[model samples]
Target: MRLDLPCLGVFFLSVIPVNASIRERLSYQGLFGCVHSGLLDHTGCHHFLRTDSGMEKTKSLIARIQFGKFFAILQSYANKDHFNYVQFSNQAVKMNQDFLEIKRLVESIPEHDDLASELSFPSHMFQLMAHSATFLKDTSNDKSRGHLSVYHLIDLSVRILALHNVRGVLDSTNSISEEKIISLHRELRELVSTFVHDGDSESIMNWMFQDLAIQAEQDLQKLWQQVSVHGIACLSKTDQQKCIQLP
Candidate 1:
């Protein structure tokens, strides 16, 4: 009998009830859990309790996988340009390292510790978003026909990044100061405006690096204004400022 997993929004051929016990559910379906099978155990922690409501988690995971595929497509574009694969691979490696770190931290903390998970998960998502952005910046050439260019991918990455970034800021223990919130929204709106202005590949790649600079500079000035009010600790300071600087 075929079964549809409601929480996962995935279809599976299972001759068992969806409401069955977790152990039995796995057995009846003849499926093995990657988390439980010691694949992700190298980082630490063995057991992972499936979230009661997995639809959202499934969606999140799916988005994460799509981002990976997007990166792959960007790789192909870069390959055609005689671009160094090592450059892109290095960026992805750094993100993966961070991803593992976040995963380790999450395992050390309780699943119910919403604060830790919220802070960490966004970091992981940001890495994915940043990777996509880098792919666009590095590989873009002369292309059209609604093809994925660096700017198109950058816009998509910014959308996802801004969404998760807002979530991260909101989930923090400190009350979100008004100034910081405004800066966040402003930065997001700037990204949105870029998307609106250049919906095509050539235009987006050019605009993302060119027209967006003035707006990005303005954002930094506004951020400094925020820093004056909120202080620097409100931000996640990193030594690698290269990522923040647009190409």
Candidate 2:
């Protein structure tokens, strides 16, 4: 969704579930029980942040995959058959060297003043979100609402990165076809329609989570402001109307 949307001119506002709870609402401790930012770049973690002004890939090619160690945690679980959200998230937090490596790589990068911070995920924390989301997705445990809260975190992270990918395209691109826009919207809506969440918010974890979670939401608000700007100036009058209606 992130990689493809910029080329099509930010196609999936429809990815947002029309539901009120989804409309309403993630961080490190705010992270899943065991999740952390681990980029699945074009090479791995959810396509590592594209560094070029949130624009689409200029050239397309698939990276070779070796099924990195992160994959091992998925199958190597102690329980094998079932685990709760805590069990799931902490699975990586254990003696997994790859998880540690991914965290180090994601968090070690200092912020670049040259880039628009709003159009980026802080410390690439989205990798954690993606990692946790992937893990949560594979597990069979939907036991309590905790899974939904974790998903809420993932969904929030996806939007933040999605905005990053779509940053400048609406103002700069004229090639995006109306048909492409409509098709992408329909495809996205169909995909979104299946989402179901039932829960009150989960309690905040440690101070680390609290700090990161606050920053993430603050960052999203800033990006929404940017989107609102483009929406008001949108080329098509109907598109402008949709922009004005953005939550």
Candidate 3:
């Protein structure tokens, strides 16, 4: 499926990965770099010091990103006609069920002093999934156009995942433990590795989604760069040099 957004083409082209393995590795590195660097500067990373509030927010952000990445992988498969109506429908049903459970969990958290509002399952997200499920169920009989519908579904899913309010949370965070971040990075790498080696369909899908993942990583990099550069610029010349020279 072609994206008509002009800016997106530039973003996608800029971060297109050489292959799935490289893309996965870059993602791991990007996350690690962002979390570490973000914590160094008081302006951006200080928020993470609030362990009680920050931990919950960070976990929710990670979970949301995982959901987005998973769907992006699915989109790549749908784009290549790797999924039939039944398989795609089953996956959608499962995703919706998972989302419902997530919603319940989020709602169970007391609102007194929690980040429940910020971390709650988006209502529109539920609506989108429900619509996709119905569309998949109703169109199961049409084999010829099934791929097209699935492609649209994938597109919608990706779009939702890409929403600033969703995946962008990570870009704005300053909290989270180094160990926790590292562990999440490792999990993402393992997930990507599994997709790359799973089968021809998944291998191809990984390759196709690599560009999308890279674009997302690049955005995070840009955020870090913006903050780091500004912070460095505010320091005295010697201090700036020292900051720049720090490994």
lDDT of all predictions: 0.41, 0.34, 0.42
Better of 2 and 3 by lDDT: 3
Please, what are the lDDT tens digits per residue for candidate 2 over residues 5-96?
A: 22223222322223324212111111111122333332332223223222122110000010112223333442243435565555434424
Local distance difference test, candidate 2: 0.34
For every candidate structure, what is the RMSD over all alpha carbons to the true structure, in angstroms?
A: 15.7, 14.2, 17.5
Best by lDDT: 3
User: What lDDT score goes with residue 170 in model 2?
Assistant: 34
Candidate 3, residues 1-247, lDDT tens digits: the string is 1232232223232222334365454443343333323234443322322323324324344235335534545655556735654555565565555555444444444542353454444444444445555666576676655454456446534543444222333333333322223333333334334434446553333454444344434443443355443332223422222222222
Clashing residue pairs for model 3: 48-175
Candidate 2: misplaced stretches above 4 Å? Answer: 1-142, 168-170, 173-213, 228-247
Show the colliding residue pairs in model 1: 136-150
Pick by lDDT: 1 or 2, better one = 1
